[model samples]
Target: MTIVLAAAAAALFGCGTFLLLQRQLTRVLVGLALLSHGANLVIILAAGGRGAPTFVGGDEDRALLDPLPQAFVLTAIVITFGVTSFLLALAYRSWLLTGDDEVQDDVEDRLIVTRWSVSEELIDAEEAALAAHAEDVARREMDEEAHR
Candidate 1:
């Protein structure tokens, strides 16, 4: 039924999105595959259910099925398969180069997590305290020189 297909598509899409968020390259690849499948299912459902061939036939009572969607889904499937294979190969290469399939955080992400966690006000206060200490030390050095 259409309802069942819709539910299946939604579930696949949700699962795929969840997997895509993982750090592992393998999981990401799998997620992409699931997402592609969900999209294909939606496309087929949109076209309509299975019926007679789209081409003109002798049977006047038979409903002709639209073939455009089927053709499109087939093409998309082939493309997705090729792309998924390439991505899997890349993930495997990454694992061979390192020991794990998990992707490392980029500099930008690390900076956002670490550098932005410190408050600007706190940093300013710390800098001011250090400057005051430096000035006091310099003043003492000058005083000792004057006494000598």
Candidate 2:
């Protein structure tokens, strides 16, 4: 049934997203696979109920099934397989080099975050100094008026 297929696709997508968020490369690869499968299911579902094959019959009364979704799914499958293979190779290489498939934080990213935090602190300090200076100026102006 359409409902069952939709549910399965939803489950696949949910699981895939969860796995994709993991730091482990292997899990990410599996997640990518699941996501692709879910996408394929969605394409099929969008194609609607099956009818006679587009080229199979000469009868004008029978509706012909649209082949576009099927073609798209096939292309997607090939692309996904290629990407999966590449990821597998990368994961294997990572495991060989580091003895684990877990992805580590990039030094560049950490540096950027550190710099951003420092910049924020500096901005806050500058704003506070400016506010204090403004108050001092206001107080001086009031004192001058009172003396006059």
Candidate 3:
């Protein structure tokens, strides 16, 4: 059923995302595979009901099934396989070089985070100042009205 396939796709995507967030290269590769499978399932589901083949002498009464989704899925499968193999090779190289497949944080990423935090702090301070200024203006207007 469509509902079952949809649920399966959702589950695959959820698990893939969870694994993709892991630091280990193996887990990331597995997650990528799961994500690709989920996508393929979605494409097939979107293709709708099955009908007679588009080949010659096919049933004229029945509708012909669209072959585009199947072609897309096939192309995606090939691409995914290539990417997976390349990543596997990279993981193996990393293991060879470091004796582990765990990815380390980049220095550039840390620097970016530090800069972001500083900017965020500045924004908070600016917001606070604007809020105080608005309050002062409101208070002065109320006082002037009261005096008048």
Each prediction's RMSD over C-alphas, in Å, is 14.3, 16.3, 17.0
Candidate 2 lDDT, 1-148, residue by residue in tens: 7888899999999999999999999999999899999999999887766455666773667766778989999999999999899999999999998899999876445555566567777656666766786898899999999999
Q: TM-score for each prediction?
A: 0.68, 0.69, 0.67
lDDT agreement with native, every candidate: 0.84, 0.86, 0.86
Best by lDDT: 3
Give me the runs in candidate 3 sitting further than 4 Å from their true place: 50-61, 108-148
Location of the lowest summed lDDT over 10 successive residues in candidate 1 = 106-115
> RMSD of model 3, in Å?
17.0
lDDT of 3 by residue, 55-139 (tens): 5545757666777888999999999999999999999999998899999866445545566567777656656766786898899
TM-score of 3: 0.67
Better of 1 and 3 by lDDT: 3
lDDT of 1: 0.84
Colliding residue pairs in candidate 2: none
